[model samples]
Target: MKFRRKHYTDDTLLALYKAILKPRLIEEKMLILLRQNRISKWFSGIGQEAIAVGSTMALQEDEYILPLHRNLGVFTVRNCPLHQLFAQFQGKPTGFTKGRDRSFHFGTQEHHIIGMISHLNAQLPVADGIALADMLANRNKVTLAYSGDGGTSEGDFHEALNVAAVWNLPVIFLIENNGYGLSTPNNEQYKCEYLVSRGAGYGMKAVQIDGNNVLEVYDTIVQLSAQMRENPHPVLVEALTFRMRGHEEASGTKYVPQVLLDKWSALDPVSNYEKFLLQEGILTEAVIAEIRALIKEEINVGLEKAFLDKMPEADTKQELQDMYKPFVQTAHAPANATKTEKRYIDAISDALRESMLAYPNLVLMGQDIAEYGGVFKITDGFVKQFGKERVRNTPLCESAIIGAALGLSINGYKAMVEMQFADFVSCGFNQIVNNLAKSYYRWGQHADVVIRMPTGAGTAAGPFHSQSNEAWFFHTPGLKIVYPSNPYDAKGLLNAAIEDPNPVMYFEHKSLYRSVAAAIPDSYYTVPIGKAVLTAIGEDLTIITYGMGVHWCLEILAKHPEIHADLIDLRTLLPWDKETVAASVKKTGKVLVVHEDCLTGGIGGEIAAWVAEHCFTSLDAPVMREGSLDTAVPFAPTLEQNFLPKYRIEEKIKKLLAF
Candidate 1:
């Protein structure tokens, strides 16, 4: 087959030949290992090597690249040590994330190659945020985000493109069209003739390229990257490549026809590029053979090193440390005020409104927040007070909503993003875990964003509408998790969260939103971000809780003043106030942990275990825990009251008193 070639240089051809050989050898060895049962599974970027290499070469060393799962070629070209990549694939301790992250989530910011998120299309908006950061910082570094054609079908993709284009961020959304997303083929993935056309609707610069042709891929990226740098607008570069292997290790080519594979195989990018290199006089047949042998040898060494790498230690103690990294000590508040007054929702609103006034850079955005004052009315009158620019309403795209907020914060604006309910936050979890949590630690990219979601049960909204998912964020590092149970702490802790340099997941119990009210102080203040507050001081026993549980425990204390129960409300769960908790438990000589989340791996378990380990000497009896049952929060009001942790605080307090 004859292929048309345009202006091409010797260096470009040589680069292509090098790029294609590296991944091809790795894939070849991976297949061999898979057949020999040396590894469980493998996914090869065999057919798509050219696009990764060509596009990456167009980028500056300081620019960022977000690769997808099948982006080994990009990783290899960017000097991501092959041994580390394979170790990550093997789930070894020497992996980039110290084996805490999965294989695809591997990257070193030192190489300006940001990690990839396994979820499709999730990286697009994050790329926009990173690019926006560069633009605001007056840096010329662009961010190139790669995803599959199927990813274009996700709402995140459209939302990200729209925001990036509208803001004119310097980002390139590279969609490698390998024709199938798992078992679903391109025909099923979209009705639109092509994915890049979606960008036109969003007013972004879009182009389609023959991804298998290294020359075409490089030339096209050279043009797009240069244009994006100058204009500082986002563009979509759809690289039409072919996935020669199965979707993953477990998947087989049975779902796809052999004929199609043969057809795409005929256009083998490595062989095509090898021919191009020789034809351009950039390489002789001897040089190509030598390069292939060198790449294979390099792959063999990396594979051997990976096999010899140590497995990650599965010790819970080590895991705990890994889970709670980036922890900072926060000063606890003074003795509980003799007078306590305020409603949790009112306190939250005050915190947001006051923070906006105090910090000009602090902006608040959400759906129906500007006029409707939020579905829960938490931000009532905020828009009127802060103006449209500062307190704006966004479209009904949850993924985009948080994505844009992240982008804003990355650009030096402290953004408070409110998801109507915690349940809906699943739409933006990819952005939260993959992008927001890791950005700062990965590339020194700070994301000072606050994500407020009303979580927990007792609303009787059923599984989809009501849930407590603090554990999700708690499991992720580089994020602060705060769950305040009262009005005073809500207002104070929220102020601190907004000011903090890291991303924070502020979980307000949905059941506490307006169900009860208290008198919140009018003065602007900040409560420490990772500290607990002692609601009631006593000596007989200690009751630990947060969010709704704090109020419930306080109510129990009010009814039984003679019980001598000490109540500690954990205002922040991530950097939890261990000092305050331990001191209280030591004084009481007995302790009970309470929370509204599920019993299994609930935040309370961690607290109870910690107290057991650290405060066991002072304990007169076994430490107790109270949390919602293992079952899901039911929709029925009566069942919800039983399934939820509304009454667990009282029950636990009674048990402690009896002990």
Candidate 2:
């Protein structure tokens, strides 16, 4: 094969040779380990090493690279230790994820590599966020995000690319078109001639290149990197390559046609590059052999040590405790108090203002968050105060907003994302549950992002607009759920959430935005996340609730003064103050949980269960719950009131007293 020379030095040619050879040898050894049952599974980059190495070669040591499962050559180029990579493959305690995850599901903050999620194209928005952060900090670093031809079909792919282009972010979208997404061919994925062409629709520069040729891949990426450094605009590059092996070691290539397989096998990237090196006189036969032998020897030694490494012992208690560590803050509250009376909405806005001023890297992103000041005016003056760079108004993309926020958070920026309404959080559920919540546990990394959700039903906003969706996140581990009942807690918690080193779903009741007001302290203070506040103390029974339900419980107590009960506001749902609830349960000897969300699968059930399990002997009556009927929230005010009326809660309280 005749190769085009693009003015590459001998050292650069040899470096590329070593880069391709290392991953090829390591992947070949991984296949042997899979056969020997030493490693669980293997996803090979056997024929696509050039794309991985070439795309990453131009990246500086401090720049970020988000690589997929098959991009083993990326780790090699990043100088990730072979023994650690082998340990991760073998599921040892010393692995990147502490052996909790396998095969490209791990990354280290120290390496500046964003670990990949199994869901394809999900990391693109995250990469955009990292680039956005770099841009905000005036850092001249570019983020390289890798995906496959099949990933282009996912909604996240388009959302990520669009945002990157619109913001002119320094992110390179490298799509390794391996002709197949698992078993499905490229034709089934899209009818477009090339994936790179789609970038035009997003207003981004696009290019297509033969990924098999190492020199071409390197030159193209180097040029793209240089362009991105100067202009900071996203560039989509479709590197045409092929998945020469099955998706995983256990997945047979029986579905693939042998002719197609043989065609790609003949154009093997490693072999073709070696031939090019030899023909160009950049490497002699002896040198090529020596490089191959050295890589194989290194792989063997790493494999032997990794195989002997111990597996991590299971510790459910420690794991759970680690997942919910207390939020640590770097900034202190102002010593002098500037007390002021403000509505819930104003309090929230003030918190955002204070936090942004306190932390220069703090960012606010959402639909209508900047110029429009959000739908509820919660961020009314953020744009003018913080400017468009920090207070960004994103497209109507809930998933990307959250995904990008996660990326920014991981890259050392504090991002507060606003989901227009709580009901819409379902759109970004995967990013929240799968990526945001699990990032810390999977890779021991913090997605220090706060998602502010305008929640609850009060103005008859119907099902989609008004929903108490805190329960959706309550069940998800590695997330902190805070539902503030008043302006004081709202401001304090929002500040705390923004400063916290984890993903927090901060729910603010839409009804209470203006209706709830108080003379909140104007000094920075974090309402303890997991602690519940005792509103009214009594002895007959205990009413535990949060959000709008807290106000309803207060209304119920005022109406029926004869029914004396301790009212406990559970501000944080996930790590609910068990001690406070149990102590109140012991004193009152009765428990009743209330909320506005549907009765079925509500956080109330979990609260009831916990009280029953922990304070069984103290309970003088059955643990009861009051919630809306198991149906969609109605649009009509009468129906909405009937659905979750104050009378219904009173009825439950009466029944608990009778018991």
Q: What TM-score would every model get versus the actual structure?
A: 0.78, 0.98
RMSD of each: 5.2, 1.5
Candidate 2, poorest ten consecutive residues by summed lDDT: 324-333
lDDT of candidate 2 over 1-659, digit per residue (tens): 34566787889888988998899888877777788887788898888998989877877878999999889988889888888988887778888977888988977777788878889889999999999999988888899999888898998998898889889999999999998899998889999887877988999899998888888888888888887888899999998888888988678788889998999888888888888888888899898789888888888888788878888899888677666544555545655677889999888988888889878988899888888888888778778877999999998788888899988987889889999998898988899999999988888878888999998887888989988888899889999999999998898888878878888999999889889889988877767778899999999999999988889999989998898889999988877999999999999999999988999999999889989999999989999988988889999999988887566998889889998
Model 1, residue 298: displacement in angstroms? Answer: 4.9
TM-score of 1: 0.78
- Which ten residues in a row are the worst by lDDT in model 1? 331-340
lDDT to native, each model: 0.79, 0.87
